[model samples]
Target chain A: DTAVSQTPKYLVTQMGNDKSIKCEQNLGHDTMYWYKQDSKKFLKIMFSYNNKELIINETVPNRFSPKSPDKAHLNLHINSLELGDSAVYFCASSDSRTGFGEQYFGPGTRLTVT
Target chain B: QQQVKQSPQSLIVQKGGISIINCAYENTAFDYFPWYQQFPGKGPALLIAIRPDVSEKKEGRFTISFNKSAKQFSLHIMDSQPGDSATYFCAASKGGGSTLGRLYFGRGTQLTVWP
Candidate 1:
């Protein structure tokens, strides 16, 4: 079984479209994070949620929003997607309550905005 | 800003040789350092980690050598094999009860082990 999983491994859409990427972790972790990997292969954290509470919000655009309905799921939604939004999005989970920050990552979703 | 800086965007090694990737961090508060390996069409997987308290850690053929004073760490892969060829990433996280899971990752180093 996959510990961390993401839906729609590949996403291709046009600009100005609204899209959402779903992520789920079955590892019973308390924290989930969303990251964007640019073409240069730099992994940058966009948002982090702990127990459905938004904790870290990087200097990301307001058009991108992350929602955590429950501890096991965190979904990312983008409004008016732009061509610059094309990148690889990865979801990770870690149980910070245990005092260790070892995160498990999902397969990643490649987003392409044309 | 790029908190972690990795060197040699790519490397090529022959089978049974050694491969080394180095990284450095500017934040002195970072105490936890971990290396990740990623293969094509897959996410990164944790390979090994070390804390500032220790100078080195080893797991099988992979070894992490750290220099706390210099804020530098390196991953060494011994007996390089073609199966071991992949992209390696060096990451660091804040320590001392701070936001622990916010890892600052390096650009990454792609290793090619030719048989």
Candidate 2:
């Protein structure tokens, strides 16, 4: 079974379109996170939720929104996407009880806004 | 300020050779350091990690050397193999000992092992 899985492995949309990527983890972890990796391979955290509570939000644009309906699901929604939004978005999860936890990452969704 | 900095944007190594990548951090609060390996079309997977309390940790052919005083850490891969060719990222986080595990990653190093 895929421990951490993401839907729509590839997304291609026009500029200013709206899109969403869904993430689900079966590791029974308490914390889920969203990250963006740019063309330069710089992976940066965008948001994090612990048991459905927002814990971390980076300096991402307002167009991006993260919603965690439950401890096992975290989804990212983006509106009016810009060309610069093109990047590989990754979903990761870690057990909160583990100190210095090892994060399990999903395959990632490659988004391209033309 | 970039909290964590990694050296050598890219690296090339011959098979069976040793591969080393270094990282430095400016945040004293960062106590846990992890190195992740990523292949094309995939997310990064944790390879090895270390805590400030330990100077070195070894896992199979991978080793992490940490210097708490200098706020620096390095990843050494012994017996480099072409299968290990992937982008490697060094990351650090605060409150890791307490479970506030949000990793701040460095610009990844593209590692290519020549067979």
Over A27-50, each residue of candidate 2 has an lDDT whose tens digit, in order, gives 999999999989999988899888
Most lDDT-accurate candidate:
1
| Residue A26 lDDT (model 2) | 95
User: All candidates' TM-scores?
Assistant: 0.97, 0.96
Model 1 has an lDDT value of 0.91
CAPRI quality level assigned to candidate 1 from its DockQ score: medium
Question: Interface Cα RMSD per model, in Å?
Answer: 1.8, 2.4
Give TM-scores of the second chain, every candidate. Answer: 0.95, 0.94
DockQ for each model: 0.61, 0.60
Deviation (Å) of A60 in candidate 2: 1.1
